[model samples]
Target: MKKYKGYLIDLDGTMYKGTERIEEAGHFVDYLVRNEIPYLFVTNNSSQTPKQVAKKLNEFQIQASEDRVFTTSQATANYIAQKKDQATVYMIGEEGLREAIQTSGHHLVDENPDFVVVGIDRDISYEKYAKACIAVRNGAAFISTNADIAIPTERGLLPGNGALTSVIAVSTNTAPVFIGKPEKIIVEQALEVLGVAKEDTLMVGDNYDTDIMAGMNCGIDTLLVHTGVTTKELLKQYNSQPTYTIDSLSDYLKHIN
Candidate 1:
């Protein structure tokens, strides 16, 4: 097994399922803490801030902190900040996305903005879509946090941010730059935040399409745990495989050093 100095872990399914705790995940994290291996919990959910994410993890009995969480919202903000300083943004999302854009020193406006960013907004309205589409057509740069078509739930698969983002794209005939998993944009930025070389980081998650692919897209090693979205049987459908596959996070303890 390859040794890694840092780890990028997925939240939802990999760490816990909704409000429930994943027992093995706690132990795996504890091992990393004992050895001082750097790790960050990365998520595509742009509805919550890093501190909110950390609080949820704590409720699940997982060891995590605010700075140890990275959201696509942050990546989107960082991406925009890099492109132009003090750019004006027209947004379609909730608190997390709004906070990230503002904290990164960008302005949020309803019209004539430089960029239009779409994230998961549970209370989306036709008016919001109309304004975003109009702004994009009027020459605003378009960006989406992730292109995940669906979000998994106990109820079933529901539309994700990408699905929500398509309305504006189809209306304006423009594609938004996606900055989350399965894209190198977010991963590259995350490596800088984790302060670890890409070659020395390992991406760990339960989903093959997002987590594993994110690592592969960035030339980082990946470990796919079978506790989440991708099962052992389902994972074989992909051409590229994760560097390692384990049934649970506990199964990975032996290799942590």
Candidate 2:
């Protein structure tokens, strides 16, 4: 068995879906604890704060703390802090985005200033889209946390951040500077938070486009678990590859011993 000293793990599709926890996701954390491996729950979902994520994980019986998770919302906030004017942002998403910007020491306003940060908002409406479009047209820089077009739920796949991003793209004739997975910044931050070097780290996820690609982009070995968005059949169809593939997190432990 290949042993890793640390991990950068995806949360939504890799660990759980919506409010549903994956089988053995709690056990996987126990495995890490027993092995004394450092791991960070890294997520591109900028819709929730670290505390909120921790609460959700805890509700699922997973031992997660705010310090153990890193999110794109925090990254976006940090990115905006270094901008030219510390731009006042018109946010079109969840409270998590607004809270992150405020926590980063940047001002967030509804009416016109500098930029518009968009993330996954469950309450997405046409008015929200129109406001974001207007803000972007008026020269506010458009920033998207991630480009995930759809999110898998027990009911079905639902529109994700990318859908809203596309609207802004067409309306403003501008593309957003995405800060989430498939991009290097979020992964880098995750590594820094876990204090792990790339060689000693493994990334476990279920998506090829975001999770797997993010790990590969940062030179970390990727594990694709077939418990969420992607499946073995889909991998074969797309010719997508992962360093390791397991039917599920439960089956993954069979090789651990």
Candidate 3:
């Protein structure tokens, strides 16, 4: 067995589904603590803040601090901060997205913004879409967090960021510049925060399209847990495969030592 010094983990599927946490998810944190390995929960969900994510992890019996959670919201903030010099942004997302952009020293506006940033905003209305479209049409750079089509919920699967992004995509006749998983930006940010090289970091997630593919793209080892969106049957269909596959995180941890 190879020893890993750092981990970039997904939250919704890999650690918990809705309000329920997977058995080995907490145990894996314990193992990391005992062995002194650095770990962070990296999520593509830009709806919630880091504090909200940390609280959710606590409910699942995993002790997580605010700093341990890295969301696409943060990544978007970093992207804007690095590129722009105080620009106004039109936001079509949640409070997390608003906070992230504002905290990065950028202004959030309703009209004539320098950029249009979209995320998962459940209360999104037609007017919001109209505004976003108008802004982008007027030359605002369109930036979106992730393209996840569906989000798993306690009720069932709900519309995700991709669905909203699709509307904007059609309106502007331009694709959004993505900064989440499957793109190198999020994974690269995770590696920088974890301070580990790609070879020594392991990415554990349940989504084949985003999580696993993102890890594979970044040159890190990926483990696919079948408990999420991707199933064993789907693996055969994907051209990109994970380095390892497990029925669940519980089964994967059994071989950790």
Model 1 spans with C-alpha error above 4 angstroms: none
The deviation in Å at residue 241 for candidate 2 is 1.6
Write model 2 residue lDDT over 1-257, tens digit each, in one string.
Answer: 58788988888767777778776888998788778789898888888889999899898888888988888988788777767446688887797787888887778787785888899988888888888888888988888988888877788888989886898898778989998998877787678778988888888998887888888887889999887778777788655477898877777677877
- Model 2 regions more than 4 Å off: 82-86, 123-131, 153-155, 254-257
Task: Write the residue-wise lDDT of candidate 3 on 1-257 in tens digits.
Answer: 46788999998778887767687788878778778889989999898888998998999998688788989988888887777968799999998888788888999889999889999999999999999999999999999999888887778889989888999899779999898998878898888888988899999898888898899888999988887778899888988689889997767767775
Runs in model 3 lying further than 4 Å from the true structure: none
Candidate 1 residue 228 Cα shift, in angstroms, is 0.5
Alpha carbon lDDT at 136, candidate 3: 90
lDDT of 2: 0.83
**Candidate 1 lDDT tens digits, 1-257:** 87789999999889998777899899888888888989999889998999999999988888999999999999999999999999999999999999999999999999999999999999999999999999999999999999999987889899999999999988888989999998888888888899999989999999898899999999999999998889889988989899999998887987654
Instruction: Show pairs that collide, candidate 1.
Output: none
Q: Is candidate 2 or candidate 3 better by TM-score?
A: 3
Question: If scored against the real structure, what TM-score would every candidate get?
Answer: 0.97, 0.87, 0.93
